[model samples]
Target: MTQQDIRKVRQEERVAELCAGVVRAFSGERDLHFRGRRLHRGRMPLPWFAPHLHPSPETDDFESFRGVADGLALRIAGSDATLHRTLQPEEPVERMLFEMLEQFRAEALVPEAMAGMRRNLRHRHEQWSLAFHHSGLTETARGLLLYAVAQICRARVSGEQVVEETEDMLEATRFALAPRIGHALGGLRRDRFDQAAYAVHALAIARTVATMLHEAGGDDEAPDARQNDTDDKRSVFSLVAEMDREIVEQHVSAQSGRSRLLEEAGAAYRVFTTEYDREHEAATLVRRELLAELRERLDRRIAAQGVNLARLARELRALLAVPERDGWDGGQEEGRIDGRRLARLVASPAERRLFRVEREEPLADCVVSFLIDCSGSMKEHAESVAMLVDVLARALEQAGVASEVLGFTTGAWNGGRAQRDWLRAGRPAHPGRLNERCHLVFKAAGTPWRRARAPMAALLRPELFREGIDGEAVDWACTRLRARSEERKLLLVISDGSPMDSATHLANDPHYLDHHLREVLARQEQQRDIAIAGIGVGLDLSPYYSHSHVLDLAASTGNAIFREVIGLMAGRHRH
Candidate 1:
């Protein structure tokens, strides 16, 4: 074979090596920390390591910077003699130290100042932009230029067409690092202001440029194709009463009596007018109904799976507790484990306190009570609410917190029988998501607005037996706990707006809770620094925690709710 083919093979081999290194770094098989690896006199241990660079043993920090050096070497030498020109051990290290911090202010007292940081890393970049006509690399342009070179080197290493799983893995690392880099720079920028902003902006620019280059080189896979758009509001379609474009004719009945199938398909992709809004367009009306019918059939099939609230919660907890010994793949003991498990592990509340992800303060023990609403109006949302409450309980449990759970509903609303006994006596036959076996299995439909305060009974009274009656305990807990002094008082109320407030305020003109609630709650807030996350499961929260920080799911649904819960509570509540 000729030299060109030989060169390509060599590049692929180099890429393979780089990928193994990156995977090691990603998996924490390598020293993910880069504090001592800085090539400068003193570079602060910044977490903003560039992801575009391939992993290398020659450097401990900033593989992206090394990638730049290698890329420059490759570009300068071409396919011939490129190996000899590769970065020396100390050069890329020095370069990373220089370029990454070259733009920050140098004075310690000044904003985000480091020992010899550049004054607005953008100054040279702005100058470089001005001199786009003439060219000699500037300091600001060095990071940008080196990164482009690194990407080119990456392209050479990872070939076209065939499987580049390793290459994709490396690229994925970079993509994942973008937002992190943004955050790092964001922190420094806030401290230093001008220079930090420029430095961060430059970093973002480098990432974007590298991504575009990688895509253009045909190393990345093509995205899924979709129908094209025909609704050019700029076009006189509505004004002229018709779109005489050939696409319209191709979609309509031509002389051959074959209407254009493309027009109907366009609406499906939201490219052209949606069938739902195409009232005036007769051409789209039939296609719209056809799509609607298809949607209806699919909806019916999915509805069973759609509201698997119980199952979803259980699966999430199981997934969260995926044992370290079982590994990732359910079937495998080993062999390149995958999926967002590590990410989940990192984002887990348990991980936060144990690993000291955000604090050194030791968490104190406290009793947590979960209050559930089992009224009729919340029947549609009951399973979901149970799942959410269960998720939090499991999260707290995993974080080593003791919790007491209770469900409450009134006897007056459900044939004079309390929903609490119905829920308390039952256990779900199957494993539903989170703690669905608790209250989700019961189907006691009563108005949510009833005295559905039975769930709040445990904390209210110490001696009262919870025989499914609401309020007896909650009132007791509030009264008895009033005199006791604890370092932290933690109370979590999970409900779907079903309190005996109307009777308390209207019937008895309840002077007890209404007048004293603000004072009691205010004191509780100071003692606990209360974090009340009210999740109105199905519908709205206007009647519920509209006055507090609610994980309002009024317009959201299933997996989205689960995912957001994971995201929101990931590191929260950890000392």
Candidate 2:
């Protein structure tokens, strides 16, 4: 078999095994087996294994399957008491009514078995109702009746409101069909899954419906009319089959129209983000040779400022140093003496011993990860940002603080997956945005800043500038920090402006990326105690960061910017 086919088989087996376990736990059924992943077939709670339904693209497959298993468990458990037998009916109408009622029973019983299935089942019924409404089968009398029944069932299960026409139809049909409906519902409510009982109810309901149609048509004919006698002659099975087909076709067409509408909703600018990994062999290694020239220039500039970052490093070291504790000696310290000293004193009156004073000093273990934006917007301030990173990284190294410097942009210019698909559709190109996410590791934690200079100098290349995916970049940085052994972790972001991915906004809502960034940050805060700070090169980043600093690169030199960053880092410790 092909490798992909083998993988598919393994996946199916795994899913089946998982489902079997769930069935055993919930319903105690052992005969159940998984047939295949056929999404259209939907959930089947038959005695034997039928092709298991797959979840929709947007739904969680495992959770949906768990609910399905719960529904099946209800059936399997009910069968134990009722001793269900397969009931085969000759008429399509009988089969359709039987299956519909059975479905309704399962839906009602599912919530009792699994509380989470309540919402999922409601959504399923609602979607089924909608699919039927848009199926273009409302012209047929049987279709109208089926639609009305669906609405009523949905209302019964979900407590949803039915329309006046639905109520009127139910009222008209209730006189003849209510007994059969009530009997089947009653049996199902008691957790019985006898197909024979359901078959009798289905036959009764079908005959009543046939009779009702006959009387309405003023035709005095037997209920078992020929297939060509009336529209109701079509079996319930065929009717539902046709309805399902129509629904699928209509839904596909509707989706195509919606896609076009989404394409038109955004501005002329399209932005997108594709994840790119630069790490294969040495992803985090920033080549020292590449950054040597830039490093020398930045070092000279910093030295001219007379701020002495090395001095600050020394002070930081002192701040983080821990005091050594001394053991007990012959000193007059007002504390309890060692046991040995007391024993000696008891033996000899001249014995003199002193208590030990234990002392603990905080370790200066800190890890800082710098995330820089290399989007086109940051081209003007890239040089200075690079300079700031070089000085800060060097000072951090001198102070024995572990640090990393990373840069993020995009790989393609309006050429990401989203844009490719958009173009394939013959749609006009949207201007103003970068597509594809390309991450460059200028330096890795534990790697000295001097060795990473060459890779850091890569920032001077304008071609590396594409777009910014700030949220994902921040998440990536946080993930790296979470792996470090340092007690204090800080993520410093150098950005030119807010996260702007043009294609992402055009394909979705404009605030999609913004909301995602917010959620990522919120999640990090809740999960980890990492310090995050943002320094905007020439923009206000307050909306994106709780602790943000804005700096105008035009008005400030590299030294000034570095000091500002140092101050910001120090402020994080301020009470």
Candidate 3:
């Protein structure tokens, strides 16, 4: 790691330590620990206060970060989690508003004597407001409405002035919402200390906002009755369009009902054809110079993250190491009395039967395979994934464990040659896995990580991503892992979503691949030949894998990401 990177890592460590002490002192929650930018009470993350816990250069200063720390501490101390949970609205839009309002309520409860803390809170909120507004989130109607509600709620509850910068921009929204939520706003201030009482008013405002949003037709339209020029405009219009499409798609699927292809096929999976299946070395697919460049870039990024590889290696060594009874030791200082050493004991009377009949040694006899989902959506997270996997591989190697980096994707979009061949065969019923399987070997188990570094960069090659056939990929990775001579084998599958072969889904059923993937996982898990775990890139893989860890790639920093991965390897995830 470079000097600057080292400094950053040290600073983050100090911040975490300080914040942890603050959380403990203020909340009296002794078990809360900060990890992956989120504070966790045991394994469950306290994500409600995530925004305040982030350690950034700007927030690293005394006043700025203390405000963040104080706000978070107050949130934990003031908010009643059980009450919040019980009172939370069911609707997504309403629920978001309810949560935001609750956070403001907590921040508003700052002690009167702590003038510094009060200023800190006001300053931080203003900073956040400015940042949110400048980010163009306010350009969209929904974003602006949410921003306005947050500003008004914070100001009302804390008895502080609203951010001046956004006051003009939110004037119309504030006016529109005032008549509807005036009484609720008063109740929120009156009942700020009483969570159950405050929730009534909070929910009232939340429901009002949600109702307005629904009545507005879509989030694209203004929540307020008035149509301002700014309300209709959005900087990233495509994102709103995409969200609309997803909503429509979900509605259509709900109406259409689920596919019964599994029952029809009688639990037997049938592939259209395996003629198009291809397995290739990932390094060979890309140009040498480009691969090297990607590797260099990855190295710099990983180094900047300043992951303590040595410490990680030690932890992995402790976790993965297996105890083995080597053999009996003769003439030991103290151990089980060995009958064979009685003669020696007689020769040296003080020795007594000191020979040890058993000796245990920790052996790092394990192989870990990382199976990556190279689906199209994963392209956005490719760089982060590559960095995480590469660092892990290096750490595993340092710990004397074998590691393999592999990926799976279809050779062509929407089932390429396999679909054409299936069509030629008159589109037979229940044709499972219509896509051409393309398994990639980025780094083999036998190869050292240093030598295989270039190929591992293939994870960043966008074109290599096409489609994901998760079930087959898992089976393939398990097979390779099981083939290893190690005493223990582990297969870690990383993916954002489920098995999605469009052609197979369309030709047979939407759930054909999903069922197959589940079946594969169940069978492998039952046999226990190898331990199968999952790391969801930005999703929950619990539906598929029994043991899974969800990594929020967007919210987490590199060190945080690595720590989470290590926790997964140590089997810290929920069973």
Top candidate (TM-score): 3
Cα displacement (angstroms), candidate 2, residue 514, comes to 2.6
- What lDDT would candidate 2 get against the real structure? 0.56
Worst ten in a row by lDDT for model 1: 270-279
* Cα lDDT tens digits for candidate 3, 73-102: 898889888888888977666676787788
Question: Every model's Cα RMSD, please?
Answer: 26.9, 17.1, 10.1
Q: What's model 1's overall lDDT?
A: 0.31
TM-score of each: 0.25, 0.45, 0.54
Clashes of each: 23, 12, 0
Model 2 worst lDDT window (10 residues): 250-259
Residue pairs that clash (backbone atoms under 3 angstroms), model 3? none
Instruction: Tell me model 3's lDDT, rounded to 2 decimals.
Output: 0.76
Candidate 3 segments whose C-alpha is farther than 4 A from its true place: 1-258, 265-267, 327-333, 336-359
1-575: candidate 2 lDDT, tens digit per residue: 23343343334334545665665666544444433221111123243211112233222355555555555555555433232225534554544554555555454555455567676554444444544555555445555666665555445543546654335655654554456465543443343244456445545545555454434433333457534544544543344566434423422110111123233545332333233334321222335554466556656655655556767677556544445444434444456666555666667777555454454544567888899988888887777777677677877788778889988876666547656756676655432233566777878997887677666677666677877777778988898898998888889889866676667657555565565565567677666589887775644354455555655555554355555667677653110
Work out candidate 1's RMSD over C-alphas.
26.9
Model 2 RMSD vs true structure: 17.1
